[model samples]
Target chain A: MAKATSSAPPAGSHAAAPINQSLTPDDKIGLYRLMSRIRRFEQVSLQHYQGGKMAGFLHLYIGQESVAVGTISLLGENDHVITAYRDHAHALAVGMGMDECMAELFGKATGCSKGKGGSMHYFEPSKNYWGGHGIVAGQTPLGLGLAYGLKFKKLKGAALCYLGDGAVNQGAFHESLNLAALWSLPVIYIIENNGYSMGTSQSRSSAYPSCLAERAAGYDMDWELFSGEDIYEVRARTQVAIERAHTLSRPAVLEIATYRWEGHSVADANKEKYRTKEEVERFKNEHDPIQRWKRVLIEEGIASEEDLKKIDKEAQKEAEASGDFAKASPYPTPESIFEDVYWEVDNKTDAGQTGRHFFND
Target chain B: MPRRLSYRHALREAFDEELARDPMVVLMGEEVAQYNGAYKVTEGLWDKWGDDRIVDTPISEAGFIGMGIGASMLGVRPVMELMFWSFYTVAWDQIVNNAAMVRYMSGGKINCPIVIRGPANGGTGVGATHSHTPENILANFPGMKCVCPSNAYDAKGLMKAAIRDNDPVMFMESTKLYGEEWDVPSNDELPDGELFIPLGVADVKREGSDITLIAHGRAVITCLKAAEILEAEHGISAEVVDIRTIRPLDEETILESVAKTHRAIYVEENKPFCGVGAQIAYMIQSTIFDELDAPVLRINSLDAPAIYSPPLEAIQLPTPEVVVEKALSIC
Candidate 1:
């Protein structure tokens, strides 16, 4: 429901007008479909990766589907999103096809990045999904810039920049926070604290008495912490933060408590050493984001078990097809390495024609 | 008629003109705005453009530089000022990892049209940390272009070109030459009514047949001085080639000069180990080995950290005396 605002919202208040919290049945079912698709895609991608179909880093987003889908679902037309390397879920959430994404993982010419950017870098400028930045805390400032660009252009949208618990300690992250607050940039920093910065647990890596979001207090920014198990709660709360950014032109910190079931990367052999099997299983059994959302949909009568199963089966088939597509896709040629190094070169501008751009040339 | 303008004002005029022409262009860095830049290169810009366009960031190089890279991706052309190129180390990951790699990593879908400009020389007695010449370090990156302008004319034109180009340009200015005045054609006097020196083009400061003194930035000025002495005393007319753009180098001009002169000496204020001159010397030897009367040589800053003492620091950078001596040895 839209509440007509008599005047500008008081300083530091929620959005001037109340944001609509209602979700249609299609929207809820769509969320379930996206989450299921991401889970299956990740599982199949992992199986292929283990089978030597893919090389390099594969930071799977299993057990953390709700965070990306929940938060990104609330984005408006002008809104943009950027995130760290655990970015497949966000890429899928932003409506990128599984074929290109899996092809990218398999280093194929038909990949999203044409096999240049593997697991860590997926970009779709048309969708306003900036990239899958590999450097920790590197995208934070870029996120701040996305907001800065919006504010400078007089647009009414926010940039949702997602980072992990490990990135919080980076100097760049702190610097980005100060700049965001200082400029009042419309950015929502979504800290998906998955309880580990690689092998080290959150306690060993980050020094916080309560939670990571509390660090925002130093910057005098609004912040909140919540569980990532429920997609509805994720959507409702993220909407408030997005509203705060859109209306007040303020920055915020939304720490969604998430847990990753896989090792930091496929190569991290010490995943078993740092944490026990029981701890991982317990989180999967109790706080699984997909299972919790499944229960909620059933309780709300939005979808029956059979309806959810249909979505799951369809998701599984799509994921399986993507693997086949990746296998069939041709690998990028050796000579094509010189392409896409510069925009001018790609367009064959005067700058590109003048000098020896590539060393090989 | 072309008038005398300091290298500093020429750079300012480029910024002023570009900012006026493109609303997407913005200048941001520490003390760039209200403080008028650390070296006063950005004087009067804040008052003219106001806080929004002329922003003063904190003492966070990694933060603002990375932010500039990000902003550029979204179509905002950010001229990020690093007060000293030495501080580029603080933001190396952002500059090299992000800015340099973004376009290629995105498979040409995105462009980081950012110009990271600051003084990158070691002549002054600013000690080791402050006095780093990193043109070679930056030019090594394929996606990033490096420009080291030696005079007001090249500085103004190259600054404009770097800003307009659709790629990351690492513009390394010299503190020694910022205040030096040179004849720069007014925009109104130009055929196109705007001065834009294209990148990857070399300017022959002084033409000769005896030898070629190839240099960039302040070292170009040094070579010009050495050319005069070589002609007067040694009776050797040396060609001074200002290879303005390091990457996408003007190899044609350098080779043309060397082919005519039959001897070349690559000079720079950077250290000899893997310096910009190292690559130039190698290119000269490898490409035109038979054209040379003598082996290609290099005149670099005395191999050590920039000295703190005033007199020693003066001698530490490539002087006209050293260039003349090196040229005579080769000629």
Candidate 2:
């Protein structure tokens, strides 16, 4: 029941922080447009995946857009972000071009990863977006290391690492928690608990008292559970964690309760069998983050209905253009497979010249 | 001037020099810092470098290894120490998948300039679980550099090269040879003012005309011992070639040795099936079949889980006697 309203409880309740009321109208509208773009991009990617134009797994972030949008909006210049396979929303929020992301899905040479890394391995080092790792809980320690680098360099920055509900149970995640607390690394472990790990429901997969984030108590780290339906709430709550990380070099766990409209992945055929149709319908009708944020924008006089509709249409058009761009992009040359395997080899250093780097070569 | 130094001290000097050379280089592992390393390879490093550079982590291989890889991504040259290379499987995903493939996967936009070094041999009494020589397993992957130094000279030089290389270098050492002394040249004595032996190069320890014995790590020492026995008693001239870097293999040196000797035997401490020796044998026969006077044979550790009995384990690994027996048949 992720209901967002102006008349919710005060800041102290449920460890909730106050929203930044001083946001400019442009900033507020920008958040909406960001969410719309992510939603539309995911929809277009899903459409292509279903049409057999794409290969590999397609994990859509349609309903969970607000979590990525709100959490990423709070990042400063030094802050970094890394996430699990459901990574398109975060990639978009990190300012990676939709064209390159779409082209990566098409396995084209112009893609962000140069057509090497498909969907589960997008990395934008320039943007400080470390990756879209494939293995469960594999990115947890990596995220911790990002924070370690910042702390080592004495930089006042944090790394926001995202994972799914099922990932909370992995041994790597627990080990990361221990190291983060032990070293006081400034890493915010954000668990987008969409209630299912692939086909298994949250209860079937994890062992918990109330929610998953409280597992942070074992590591003596601060944690909070909140709803993802409200973009304002997401921003407000996540800001507190980020400030703690930046100021104190401490770690925190955030479990944002959200829902996905589709299956675990586009390849997941048991989408309807795992959960009830009524349950899915209810989440879409009521707990939809995009619709809730749209209403909030309209009610606050931030944007008119016509303005929101225009933004939505523009996002769709942008996503469609990205798809077209991906189609027009060329596939990587067969010989190019050996490229990018080693930095020394690619750069042609003395070390690269001494050995047989590629087996075929 | 050349001085006698043990393999352990040679490795420590490499760490000490690299940590001084680059501010980004860090050493992280269990018991590495205040504990002075599990095997004392990092004995005085903690006091010298302090907490920031030399870090002691919990017994979480997967966690810290992945952390090292992650830190390496952000311009940190992390040299991770596994107490035994056998424990590498606990962090398999981090070592093989993340560290090995990250550069290629990220399209060369990111590189994991990290080194994972530890003793990886089976001659010691540390039973099956603690006794895995996984150089072949790691060498099977692309974008990974595997170095198995056979002596103090190779250990020191190869280690420095591995630490500086812009790739994940799997530095495998041998506990049995860690304390053995070898004549290592001081930095001022070298032409480059540093003992930097480049990776993917082989050194011929002994010159011979009868047979070529290709080996790496501890097996090179074994081959040298066998060459002595063969020359003294059997009157056979067996050349010993140390292929220091296994992944970027020095195939040219190996081929040249085989071409001159016309008889070859691959030797290793790893199991026979799909071992590093297996790959060497395949390359020799596949490319230079005409040069070989006899089928290129191999003398490897007995193909079984490393046994617990001290006497049995001693016989299980390739000794000078076993190498002589294998070479006599081939020569």
Count of clashing residue pairs in every prediction: 0, 0
Residue-wise lDDT of candidate 2 within B157-233, one digit each (tens)?
Answer: 99999999999999999899988999998898889999999988999999999999999999998999999999999
Task: Note the residue pairs that clash in candidate 1.
Answer: none
Task: List where candidate 1 sits over 4 angstroms from the true fold.
Answer: A1-21
Best by TM-score: 2
Worst 10 residues of 2 chain A by lDDT: A1-10
TM-score of A-chain in each prediction?
Answer: 0.94, 0.95
Compared with the true structure, the alpha-carbon lDDT of candidate 2 equals: 0.90
Model 2 spans > 4 angstroms off? A1-19
True contacts kept of 1: 0.64
Per-residue lDDT of candidate 1, residues B34-111 (tens digit) = 999999999999999998899999999988898888888888999999999999999998899889998877777888
Report the CAPRI category for model 1: medium
**Residue A289 local lDDT, model 1:** 87
